[model samples]
Target: MIKFLIKGILRDKSRSLLPVIVVATGVFLTVFMSGFLKGIFNDIAELNAKFNTGHVKIMTRAYAENKDQVPNDLALMDVKKLLSQLKIDYPDMEWVKRIHTGGLIDVPDSFGETRGQGQTIVTAIDMLSPGTHEVERMNIKKSIAKGSLPVKQGEALISDEFAERFGVSLGDKVTLFGSTMNGSMMFNIFVVSGTLRFGNTILDRGAIFMDIRDAQLALDMDDAASEILGYFKVGVYDDIKAQQLQASFNTKYSLKDDEFSPQMFRLVEQEGLGDYLKLANSAGTIMVFIFVIAMSIVLWNTGLLGGLRRYSEFGVRLALGEEKKHIYKTTIYEAMLIGIIGSVIGTGMGLGAAYYMQTYGLDVSSITSNIGMMLPSVYRAEVTPSLFYLGFFPGVIATVLGSALAGFAIYKRKTSQLFHELEV
Candidate 1:
């Protein structure tokens, strides 16, 4: 019976061609949109992880509350000792130390007088840490706009925009003046080794990156760091695991009833990110639902037209003593086959497009520059397991649902009436 139905559909283009095209087109769009949105969210999360927050972070309670000030005085002391203990305690995760501070960069002319000066946000990164992949993880090699990464002490990477504004270039020596952890004056001379462009407005405006040892020496903050960042082995954020780690670490390390005690925070806990991510996920779900409803309505209308066109055929079958229930069931089986075929083809095409987008993304530099947002130049699609089967919900289910609704008309067609209508 199924073979006969398949053969009939093959012979009749009107019964299969248009419906297949509609279902395939709808499924293709559904898959593409899912991948595209997932890509955007994933990209943003990674950027935040690398630039602002790690998968998890540890800092002083006072600094966590007043982090906007870049409070070096509240930084963790004896970082090497603490990190050693942390490594032994939690060997599953990678750890990196960082110092955040604010300072003034003074560019000098040949006469030793200041030529230009800018207020800058400074980030001190571990340059000589053994067994660390911070450089590769941050993509510092690719983000370099001029010169190269710093290889020696007293060298730093300044933002391209900051360098341009100060009329500075590679090999230029500059003075950085900042406050020490003990509320004392601190200053150091640094040669500009590289200029970096992160494609982010915050970094481009007035940012500086320096070696951790140099920063510690300049600030007189020996063996101290603003925060200790933790990353997963896979370099991806897992909310539940991160939160669990944070809870365990805080419970173990945090001092109770002490304002200066250190505390741990998951990526989602800091900067109100938990709410933002939840909202973005909800928005994606709403978008998928909207697409499904819109496609279902369109397919439903097409099914009604196809059913009306088959009125004569149904009448002939009814006059020949075929049961109405049997005719209805056959229509459902035919719709199921069409749904399967269309979904398979559409999913393949969508995945191919997604892979292309993932490899070579669309450049939106102009858009990001205009908005002054922290966005990358290229936007890519993310292909996941969900993307592979997400289209099936709308493709197979909607097609079958629309076809089933249309088939209900089979019951209203009386044999005598249909024969008279057909004979006329």
Candidate 2:
């Protein structure tokens, strides 16, 4: 019976052809679309990590609120101390780094090469414990195109784009000047140590790196850091986890009874970086809708034909004393086969597409002018296992299997009515 069913399906090549093609196309689209979304999210994650935030950052109360607290005051230095003590207690949160940020500065033609103020950006950083901010520092360092990192207070690292923006080369003497946190005048001479390119437009265009000491002194904060940056292997992007880890530093400093605002949690999601998160979510939802609508049409049409054509065969099976359930199961098996085949093909195609896109980011600059973004426009698909599960596999299986079962519903009738279907 099974062999005969196979032969019957194979004999009607034209009827079966579209179904297979539909399955394959649907599967392929699911995988391809999912991988694309995953890629975009990953790129955004990387961008955020390199330029703005890590998995999470702990900022001072006023800083997150933008209420204008002292620019360089460490509102939570006690919290950092508590972190050290908490590590002794919990041991799980041994990794944490303090990060301080300050105003942008420009190197003048007075010191050396003539990159005007508009062309250069200098940012001050402080090294906490010579330990923290090291890994990120290295990552930030490698992105540099030329010149070495500035280890001492006087030295500085300039991004490659800044180098090109001002047409300055390595070893160029640049004068760095910026307002202190106290609004006092500040100036320092820095040798261009390295050129940097971070794949982030803002960072690439106008960002400079200096030792934390340089940042603190340049900003005239004097041992006052903006926030304590920390590192941990897990529990990133969770405010509750941060609150729990705050216990690890218990002995180092006292934790106030005060509650931290949701804004205090500096996860990428909470920071509200806009489309960095929104576009990803939107794409995922959009893909699902498209897949459903697309698959529905494909399945409904295939099911109708597959059902009507097989009606006579089903009637004959019933006449031969095959149970209705048995017929349904057989049809389901056929649907499963088509689904499996389509899913395999789709996954393979989707992976290939994703890999290609990852290597060459989609250039949307041609349309950016039309869309009008203040930032440079680039889009890359983000791929993840979740995306795969959501987009490709489920859609194919549900559509194919459901379609096969739906096809069998057309076979429903009394044994006396079997001849009627056969006659048609």
Candidate 3:
């Protein structure tokens, strides 16, 4: 029976071509859109983790509340001891110290006079520590648009754009004027070892990077850090595991009554990211739902039109003693076969496109430059294991559903009335 249906569909292009084309196009879009949306949301999460938040972050309760203000005065104290204990307690995670401070960078001329100055946000990390992966994690080496990574103490990297704007160059001395952790005025000079462009507009605007040790000296934060970031050794954020870790660590170390006590926060819990993630997920789901419904309606119309066109044919089959149920069932089987074939072809094409996109992303720097967010310049598609079957939901089930609805008319035509219709 299946062979006969296949041969019939092959012989008659009108019976199979248009519906197959519609199903294939819908499936292709479904797969591609799913991959694209997944890529965008995943990039946002990963970028935040690598640059700002870790999979988990540890900070003083006071600092956590005012983290947006970059309040270094409320930073974690005795960080060295806490870091050592965290490494011992959570061997599966990598721990690092980070300091977030904002101040002015003063560029000096040959006469030791200030040539230029710019307000800057500084991020200090464990760049000089042996066996540390912060450099690779942040893509600092690749992002260097000029010079090289800092090799010695008191050297830092500034944004290439900031350097250009201030007429600064490599080997220039820049004075950092900022307040210490104790809220005291402080000034320190640093050599410009390199310039970088992180491809994020917000970070590349007026940002500076320095070693955590240098920041400690400059900010009077010895054995202290604004925040201690913890990342899974696997370099991926696992929300459930992170939540479990946060709960356990808070229970053991954090004191709700003590503002100075250390507290742990999962990635989603910080920076209003939990809401952002929820919004992204909701948007993706709504987009997919809209596409499916749109495609289903179009396919349903196609099935209805095809069934109407075959009315005379169905009437002749009934006159030849064929049961209405058999004819209806055959139409459904044919639609299923068309759905399967279209889904396979469309999934292959969509995956190929997605793979290419993932390899070489689409650049949207011009569009995102003015936007004050941490989004990357390039957009890529993320083809997951689910994408292999994601298309079948719309391709197979929707097509079959449309055909089932259209086939109901098969049982409505009476054999006695078919003779009168056939004559007309």
Stronger candidate by lDDT (2 vs 3)? 3
CA lDDT for candidate 3: 0.88
Q: Rate the local accuracy (lDDT) of all candidates.
A: 0.84, 0.59, 0.88
Worst 10 residues of 2 by lDDT: 258-267
lDDT of 2: 0.59
Over all chains combined, what TM-score does candidate 2 have? Answer: 0.73
How do the residues 1-424 of candidate 2 rate in per-residue lDDT, one tens digit apiece?
6676577557777545666677667766777767776665655554454334544455555555562333443334444454465457556443343334434445556544445665444444443346555536446655657766665556777777667877777777776665665677767666776777655565666677777666666666554545544445552344467566544333233335432311234344444554566676787778767776777677766777777777777788889998888887877666666666566666677767776776676876455534322332466665556645564565566666557647657456679887775786
Q: How far is candidate 2 from the true structure (C-alpha RMSD, Å)?
A: 5.2
Sorting all predicted structures by TM-score, with the top scorer first, yields: 1, 3, 2
lDDT tens per residue, model 3, 210-277: 99999999999999999999999987788999988998999999997999999999999877788888
Worst 10 residues of 3 by lDDT: 287-296
Model 3 TM-score? 0.95
- Model 1: ten consecutive residues of lowest lDDT: 366-375
lDDT of 1 by residue, 312-360 (tens): 9888888887899999999899988988878877788778888888888
- Cα RMSD of all models vs. native, in order, equals 1.7, 5.2, 1.7
Per-candidate TM-score against the hidden true structure: 0.95, 0.73, 0.95
